[model samples]
Target: MTGAPTPVSPQQIPAAYQQALRLQNAGQLQQAAQIYAAILRTRPLAEPCFQLGLISARTGRRAEAATWFRRALEIKPRQIEIWTALIDVLDGPERAKAMAEAQRLGLIPSDKSAAAMRKALAELETGDPRKADRLYRKALEAGGDPVPLRETWARALFDRTETDAALKVLAEGLAKAPADPRLLLTRASLLETAGRIDEAEADLLAVLDARPYHPLAWLALMRARKQPPGAPHVATLEQRLPEAAADPEATRYMSFALAKALEDQKRDAEVFAHLDRANTMTRRKFPWNFEADHGFLRDAIAAWTPRTRGQSGAAPIFVTGLPRSGTTLVETILAAHPQVAAGGEAAVMTPLLHPAVEAWFSKGTDYDAQAIGQAYVAGMARKLGAASRDCRTTDKSISTYATMGYALDTLPDARFVVLERDRRDVGLSIYKNLFRDGTHRYSNDLTDIARQIRLFDAAVAAWRKRIPDAIHIVDYEALTADPEPHVRALLDFCGLPWDPACLTPERTERQVHTLSSVQVRQPINRGSVGAWKRFEGALQPLIAALDATRYDFG
Candidate 1:
């Protein structure tokens, strides 16, 4: 309809297929889909259907494409390539049905290849990643060339937090498929997470060279350079990011890369521009609204509020804000106090009160106010490893306090420290950090990152207005510029007597699973405060927007 839907003949079909692939590669997804659909409508060919299914999955219409693929397989049953498409399209129940159908017709070999895949899928669905890892490994042992199986096995292990094993698997795969972009990228991610930034750079650069438009690879390369234990590669990344951003997949990552680079250079405005582009791309690609868990917060508050009547221990000091916001610094300082044992960013509250939250939100069920409070105290004792009877106070710090009201409502006795930093700095740090997907995708662009930060800021502000004395706002700049005084004030707020040991934060031995792992080890500095100023000219739009919103942390 648009471009005279290229007429197909047997002679012209191959060229049409190649042209369709080129369109798909260039992010002309709708055009490519039309071509593939045209090719399949008349012929019902396995190749076209498989290609169409892949395009559909990538474009987020996997279910509809899966139907066409099933129809194609009905005609030509033994296409190995179709199996890959099949796996991409099928989910939990659909996957089992597809695998069984594949086996019954001898599409997959009778011995365990089909069964193993089903087992792995089941294990993954049931929330048993370790079992899925073992099943994927077993699938490889039973014969097929081991490329896909090994790749997925590594992912399963990585999901289970068995990083060393995951790295080993990815390393073995990379050795065999040196030029394979997926293998190279996976290894790069594993290395990056382990703080092997220099090594990760090599893999990411290789991936970019092979598939220069791969955005994740570009972003990874950007991050690997920015916080290198070695040298910064900002110039190289700057040259390459535009090229990557020209492609859709790489564009989101480029947004973040640009933001981080600008932030590192103290060009806050440029950082925001990059972040805005990233958010726009993300919304275009995957549009959805996420409702805040306020009802959950409300129920939690109702449960805990009654228990705090005329009763208090040095209450659980909640250290919360955006992920990279010096939450660990707050915890480390408090942990140094004789009274506080750090319950490092545990899932205690969510797990304990999640059901009550769901019930209240879904059915308006009444919840026991006192039991909710008592349950949380017990949950903290269990997770904090504090003796229930001997505990005077235990500090529980979960960065989820970006939702301050919900937390305050649930645990009214709980003290809160709302960490604050310049939005550009916070966003830049987030983009540079390797978060394990989900909400971390917000940091993939300056606009989305800015929006999320604004949302959190707005939420916190509203909460503070409602309960002004309930929370303490901690500015990262203040903490960095005057560490001792701020630390003393924070300790005093948490009702802990400050120790001189709290000042030498590096001396405290604790696992900080954040991008600032290296930064926190250094003595406090004013380095990050004005870091976004360097790219001021390029970042004017973002600066104007910030001014318009009046989000000045200064």
Candidate 2:
């Protein structure tokens, strides 16, 4: 041998481990993560632990990063850099304590307000926006201009679905600093989510005017309007590509924006190229954990074994499917009925389901299926009472697909209206869009996305077989092509009286928070029925992967 390897690459390091390091250096974090995880399964190494922490940090998984760093520390307690990395991702008193220890190792300047800001961010991420609001206000009160925190605070509120409040926060910031691009962009997002597309476009344009070709602003612009084939923005996006090279994240957004612009122009090859670059960046940022979700399905199926359906009426209807399927459209249709309140893509069920069936087999938490169901119904009835006097509701949370068994058993009257679309279309939609960071982890890679769809179909098929009567199929193709019959059938299955309102779901008066928000506003059309054919050349790999699934949607 020439010489022994370094500490991180000791002699006889696994070939996989070396490959992971090379991939990590090349910015292929997701692939590196796969290799690192596999290596850990076979053998434990502190270096992989540290690398994982760094990877998690880059992906914005603070808690996960801290966990990996701590594991690294456990293996090699005196690694100063590992301690520093751990401190970087910690929050609140934990961060403070870690910093206090790191101080012993070296001199590092501490930002006095960072702890409070971190604590506030923790509150927002965990869904305690009120606490975050208070923390931000407290930070502003103490001293200094709190303008920097304004965008962050507004984002927290927006994430919690407090659209009006979030906008108000941004408006307040804009009042003081009228030309702040960050505030303008944040406001644009708020307007978009609130279904004020024109207003959002105006804000986005303002942001782009102040900071030309701003990457995220460009993406927002695409969503806000339909561009013609040689739109001015397309040329601007192309000419300014080199200017955005400094920020990889920004570059990714620019690619997505360019892709959208090219797509409108029907430049399929160019669209595919940009999408590949943007989606590759997304995968690096947040690697998908296929085994984790796979395990959830396996465990969930085991925990909630097959059972017959128990029935009720005009109860909560959960419209669910893979993202980009017709979940939003179905919910919009159901909401058109005066009796239904559309709770668009909300996580209300997450908290409720966890107490009932989340890892209960391992933890042995005592749960009452019927009582939980009763509680969920009562809670939803009260929750949607303001939206509808009858308190009938539609919950289109994607999690509905995963937790249908527990939900159906618990909510005696609840119905599941699942959308069935061609998996290729779903995969194409997922790959083409920029979803929220944590929303669709597998979306960046088409092969991974194909696997996700296959597994999703498996789960849905299982659920359908178990409780066929309780779950209704809304075929996306058929509904979009000839909507009236399907809409009537959907309404009928959900135990609602047919009304003319159901025929025009696009006219719904409910807050829609999905990528299809703009699409759903248009009259029901068959435009996207086989839109995946447009990308046949670009999507051959994904197509081949999916073709193996042997699936054809109803």
Candidate 3:
């Protein structure tokens, strides 16, 4: 051996990597591999090793790819994309080992775009949206293809109530990548939220032209159009269901779309059948643990007592309840008032409360009430931008009902408006709606939905007892039947002066970002009040569960 091999300097790495990437992008795989190998000889860097692994796997050398991936991981253990690639090529004990390693490293299985998106989502779910926003921006800045990044980034922005910014991002993405189906689909949804139904419909139709059999596009088209009873598309939807059977997600989308069409046509049996299939698949894909959820609720209630006082502020009004239980209606009504801005489903509270609640449950540590309060204020300010500091706002995040105690303890002056609906109506509506988010896992199972309803009732009752003056109960039926008085009462409780505009919530120009987006645009009516009775036969499980729990619908 000639003394020792020459080593590459750190200064040369970036240029070399760029060259490798150029070669790879140009389809010169052999040249890229040679460069990668040369880089490896001088320095055992993870990027080169990862590239070598990708080339090997693509070229049918699975064993060699696995070896390179292993080397890459050894050099840089937190490479999620590498871990995912290795797992794909591995098998038997080796695959098990790689999986375990990935778990230990907290590496989710995904490619570049998917990994970034997943991490961002996980951050949002855990209540660190600021971190999630940073990650999303970082991904966008390091861009080659911008379509997927833009779509996800816009969603994150939208989730934080950055509605105008989200739309601008999507518009920019569309300008760069014209007619991209995903971008079109997402933009259409945003448009729908903004009450631009015609524009939303146009975008959806364009997506369908590009991807005719796209299940999500078809579903969005149905919703945007809001086809009347016995529309011709009912048959088309029925026929396409079989074509979509091979893909579970596609099948779920088609099923829900078809059920909506059938419901419009008065085919209750077919509607129920399709709903059942869709819900069943959704439940299987994302199982819900009733006991765990109940335990968390109990812990939350137990951790915060009546004596706990929160840091006071000009508290934002919270409109919360089960999905489809008039939260949107209440928010729309309130937002119509000049002093109130509707912060549609801002997920600021629960995430801010998570760490404190966990500490209480695990180590018996008392919640940092003031810290939680400050965090919520800061988080909402970020989400709402200028709007956060504006006049009173309402956060219509329905799940906040579960964390009411934490919320009360954090923002002592905060007002909560808990919405109640006919139990059966709530159950049926939840089952029918194709919720875009993943949090409502209990919606797909009747017994689970009923149990959740009972839990919600119990939690609300407990809160009522603990802080009767702070919480206001609004029944959906009562609100719709006599909207004026109920709305006046709501305004009074929140300490707002009466205004005539609050009575015409449907005419409010603000965006309604929920399943009830379309419905909230129309005047309040009793049409949906007891509509669940029409499908009583198909909702026996829900009825029985409600009966067992002694919830009086009458």
Instruction: Choose the strongest candidate by lDDT.
Output: 3
Best by TM-score: 3
Tens digit of lDDT per residue, candidate 1, span 105-177?
4445446765796698567645466777678777766764555566666765554456788888877877877
Model 2 RMSD in Å is 9.2
Q: What value does the lDDT take at residue 354 in candidate 1? A: 62
Model 1 regions lying over 4 Å from their true place: 1-218, 225-247, 258-277, 288-315, 332-345, 351-363, 368-413, 423-455, 461-470, 506-509, 532-554
> On a 0 to 100 scale, what is the lDDT of residue 489 in model 2?
96
Comparing 2 with 3 on TM-score, the higher-scoring candidate is 3
The lDDT of each candidate is 0.63, 0.76, 0.79
The TM-score values for the models, in the order shown, are 0.61, 0.74, 0.75
Question: Rank by TM-score, descending?
Answer: 3, 2, 1
RMSD after CA superposition, every candidate: 8.5, 9.2, 13.8
For candidate 2, the per-residue lDDT at 363 reads 75
- Residue 222 local lDDT, model 2: 83
RMSD of candidate 3 to the true fold? 13.8
Model 1: lDDT of residue 504: 79
- TM-score-superior candidate, 1 or 3: 3
